[model samples]
Target: MTRVVIVGGGPGGYEAALVAAQLGAEVCVVDRDGLGGSAVLTDCVPSKTLVATAEVINQVRESGELGVRIGRSAPDSGDVSDVSTDIAKVNARVKALAHNQSEDVGRALQREGVRVVRGSGRMAGPDRVAVTLADGGTEELAADVVLLATGARPRILPDAEPDGERILTWDQVYELDELPERLVVVGSGVTGAEFAGAYNALGSDVVLVSSRDRVLPTEDADAATVIEDVFTRRGMTVLSRSRAERVERRGDGVVVTLTDGRVVEGTHCLLAVGSIPNTADLGLETAGVATDERGFIEVDKVSRTTARGVYAAGDCTGVLMLASVAAMQGRIAMAHALGDAVSPLDLEEVAATVFTAPEIATVGWSQHDLDSGRVQAVGIKLPLTRNPRAKMQGIHDGFIKLMCRPGTGIVVGGVVVAPHASELIHPVSVAVSCRLTVDQLAHAFTVYPSLSGSIAEAARRLHVRGQQAPRKDS
Candidate 1:
């Protein structure tokens, strides 16, 4: 039996440990932090839980605009500000849910018969790991393969480090006992936009700083436009094309200075400047493993590092920096290490979602295809307002877009932007994964008055793109 040792109990490590154990391998997972790793305990789960409360608040705030009577619109017609919010209860629930999820992950791993070591683990050699136990004792273990699933940490600017009080990282934001009076989110990426939208909905006067022309610049252009439009409509002060240079505490609050010499004051500031791979102090060089200049481990499709019998997965590999990608990399590593038929990782089929008000989800090739000329495909876009379900939900923005080969009619890629777009994008993912034809997708049944119908309609338009021939060669 091949012995497998996985470092870091994040989704990648835990999921791979379970797979290795099922394969009849002796699996041991060592992690300094609680089970479920950062994805569950601190970053993704906690943030999403907080966002859930924000979503509720957003819905309630919109009910008035929808003409839905909610206890008779506040007494003050001109001012109209009677809806009060309690942050203490919302924050407590968020932390409790995050803790419960972390515990559940630990319980499941234990039930799988995989040893869960709570400690910081470092490589002693290519195939040996030394665990510094929580109580300070050290334990050495040997394995046929070592999987590095250690996740990434938030990147802080040199001039503006998070003091965890006035300035905060994504993880530290969960510890807040009460909401800030004015929250300034510094970054326009997924994390930045998510927190900006969430806090704004949660009743904080929000100011979003974007170095780029629009928020979520890396996402689909149309989708980004929709989100930015909503942000402005909801009274969010969006400072586009402005990069934050420094953050300093002023009096009881903080002031963020942009490169252009303008300052924005806020009760609290959030640095959403992305993350760096966790590869320090791992003794990776001692084991003959190679890492990039940025310290991310270099691995192939099979998760094999430069050193034999050594593998790396998750954010450490810097493949996609997504938990889902990390989990897949770990499983592929175990399967290949244990003599099972393994397929190389194909990132093209990977689906990514941005959790905004109307979530944006995309899979396979993007609009970059049109610019690069890699694929000759026709694109079709349909607005959500055209859908009956969207009308019922009072959603006027967002759309479903599809791209297909003009000649072959095969669905190449697609993007969905709407409520639960993450879930609605699954069919598009299936089509892309299976390389389904446009006709096949158009034939698929989508319930009427549903968001998914828009996807099918987009496909149908592609199928009939050139159906109308030139009018008598005029």
Candidate 2:
């Protein structure tokens, strides 16, 4: 039996352990954090759970618009009772849900006959792993193959470090007992935008500082514009082209200084600059496993490292800092290492979602590719405001976009921006992965008066547009 040792208990490490065990390999997982790693314990699960609570608050605020009387109004003053969120209760629930998920992942791995070691793991050699137990003891394990999935942590600026109080990282925000009256989110990326949107919906005055020209600079341009408009309409201050130079505690409040010498003050500041992979101090040099200059472990399509029998995946590999992608990379590495049929990682086919209000989800080629003439494709974008379900739900700030080959009409990619966009993107993901054409997507039946109807509509439009395009000569 092949002896496999996986370092880290994140999605990548844990998923690989299960697959390796199922393939009859003797598997052991060394994890510093509890099972499920940051995804379940702190980052993804916790943040999304908080977003869910915020969504409820937002919906309740829209009750009057829906013709539902929430609280009694005074005849003379015309004042109705206000609805407020209990930050303590919401944080408690987020922690509880995260804990439960971590426990579930642990139990599942145990049932699969994979040993879960509570400790930090380092590569002692190409085929050896040294585990530093939580109790400070050390144990060496022999391995035919070693998988590194150490994951990552929030990246902090040199001049502005998180104090876990006024200044905090995304992982540290769950500990707050009270919501900030004024929250400053310094980063316009997915994490920053998601938190800013969620908090603003939950009744906090938020200021988003973006070094770029707009929020979600990496996402679809139209989607970002909608979200930014929503943010501005909801009284959130968006400071574009502003880079935070430093953050410090200022008399019970937080003050952020921009590179241009402007200062913004808030009750609390959340640093969402990004993340740094946890790849250092893992004996990578001793094992001949190469990493990039930023300390991200370098891995090939099959997750193989520079070392012959070593593999790496997940955030540590910097392939894509997403849980689903990490899990898939882990499975791929295990299959290839254990002599099973495996496919190389195809990043274009992967689906991802931003868990913000009017969530943004995308798969495959983007508009940038088309505009750059990198790929010949026909595309169509249909607004959600045109969808009957969106109208009923009072949603008017999103769209569904489809891209396909001009002649063959093979669906190359898609983008969905609306409530529950994450769920709506799955069919598009399937179409892209299976190389389905726009005609096939358009032919599929979608529920009427549904947000998903827009997806099919976009596909149908793309199909028509594809037919109009001139074919290439053989």
Candidate 3:
């Protein structure tokens, strides 16, 4: 039986350990943090939970616009103080959920009989890992195969690095005992935009700093435009194409300096700049694992590194840098390493979601690809406001865009910008993965008066346009 030693208990590492152990390999996982990594313990789970509360605030705030106002009698001075945000309670719940998720992952691994070691792990060789245990002891584990799934950490700008207090990383936001009076989210990528929208809904005065033409520039152009418009309309101060040069804490607030000599001051600042792959200090060079210029491990579709018997996945490999992709890569590595059936990962077919207010979920065919003639595709967009369900839900913004091959009508990909778009993107992902045509997707039944019906309608329009007659007939 082959012995597999997996480093880092994030989605990539833990998932691979499970798959390897179940495949009859003796698997051991070395993790520095609690199991479940940042995705479960801090990043995805905690952020979403906070967004849930923010969503509640949004709904309550929007009720007045919906003509469903809950009148409050003239509040006495005492009642006003009692109605403040119970941030301590919210933090408690967030921490509890993070801990619970970590516990569940740990228990599942134990039940699966995978050896779980709490430690910092570094590769000793192509087939060996050296782990420094939590209690300050060290152990070397030999393996026939080694999986590296160490995840990434927030990319801190040299001038505005987080002090873990007034300036915070995404992971450290949950520790706040009170919400900020004003929040300046620097960097208008998915993370920055999402947090800005969430905190704005939670009643914080939010300012979004984007060094781009619009928010979510890497996402669908139309989707990004809608988000930017909505953010501006909702009182968010958006500074586009402006870079933050430094962040300093002032008395009871923080000040962010822009490269353009302008300054943005807020009660707190969140550096949502980006993340760097956690590839340093893991002794990868000794093991012959090749990393890219940016320190991201270079791995093949089957998650194999240049070093024989050594593999890397997840944020470490820089494969989409998503939890779902990370998990899939891990499983792929296990199957390939343990001599099981393995399928090479197709990045184009992977579904991705940004957890913003009206979440943006997409699969493939970026707008830049279409604009640059790299992809020969026809696109159709249908607004969510036109959908009956969206109307019923009182959602005024967002749209669904579908792209398909011009000749064959095969669906290339789609983008959904709406509430719960994350869940709604799965069907589109299935269509893209299976190479289903627009006609096939159009014929697929969707619930009436549903936001998803807009997707089908968009596909139908593509189908109709594809079948249009020649101008000579006109």
For candidate 1, the per-residue lDDT at 228 reads 98
Q: In candidate 1, which residue pairs get closer than 3 Å at backbone N, Cα or C atoms, i.e. clash?
A: none
| Stretches of candidate 2 exceeding 4 Å from the true structure | 72-81, 464-466, 469-474
Best by lDDT: 2
> Highest TM-score among the candidates is held by which one?
2
Candidate 3: tens digits of C-alpha lDDT, residues 1-474: 899999999899999988988899998999898899989888988888888887776666555445554446133321111123567788799889989998999988998899998899998888789999998989999989999999999999998868777998899888888888999999899889889998887778899999998999888888788888878877899999999999998878899999999999998999998889988989999999999999999999999999999999899888788999999999999999889999999999999988877788999786567779999887877788788998887898888888888878888888898988999998899999999998899898999988989888888788745365212100
Q: Candidate 1, residues 1-474: lDDT per residue as tens digits? A: 788999999988998898898888999999888888899988888888888888777777676556554555653332223355678888788889988998898888888899989899999999899999998899998989999999999999887889888899988987787889999999999999999999998889999999999999998888899999999998899999999999998777999999999999999999999899889999898889999988999999999999999999999888898889989999999999988889899887899998888899999888777558987776878888889989888787789888877677777888898988889999999999999988899998989878898888877777755643111100
All candidates in order of TM-score, best leading: 2, 1, 3
Q: What lDDT does each candidate get? A: 0.87, 0.90, 0.86
**Poorest lDDT segment (10 consecutive residues) of candidate 2:** 72-81
Query: How does model 2 score by TM-score?
Result: 0.96
Error (Å) of candidate 2 at residue 33 is 1.0
Model 2 Cα lDDT, one tens digit per residue, 1-474: 899999999999999999999999999999898999999998999999999988777666654545555556333332223678899999999999999999999898989999989898888999899988998899999999999999999999998889999899999999999989999999999999999999998788999999999999999888899899988977899999999999999889999999999999999999999999998899999999998989999999999999999999899999899999899999999999999999999999999999888899999999889889999887878888788988887776888888998878999988888888999999999999999988899899999878888888777777655287533111
TM-score of model 1 (CA atoms): 0.96
How badly does each model clash, as a count of residue pairs? 0, 0, 0
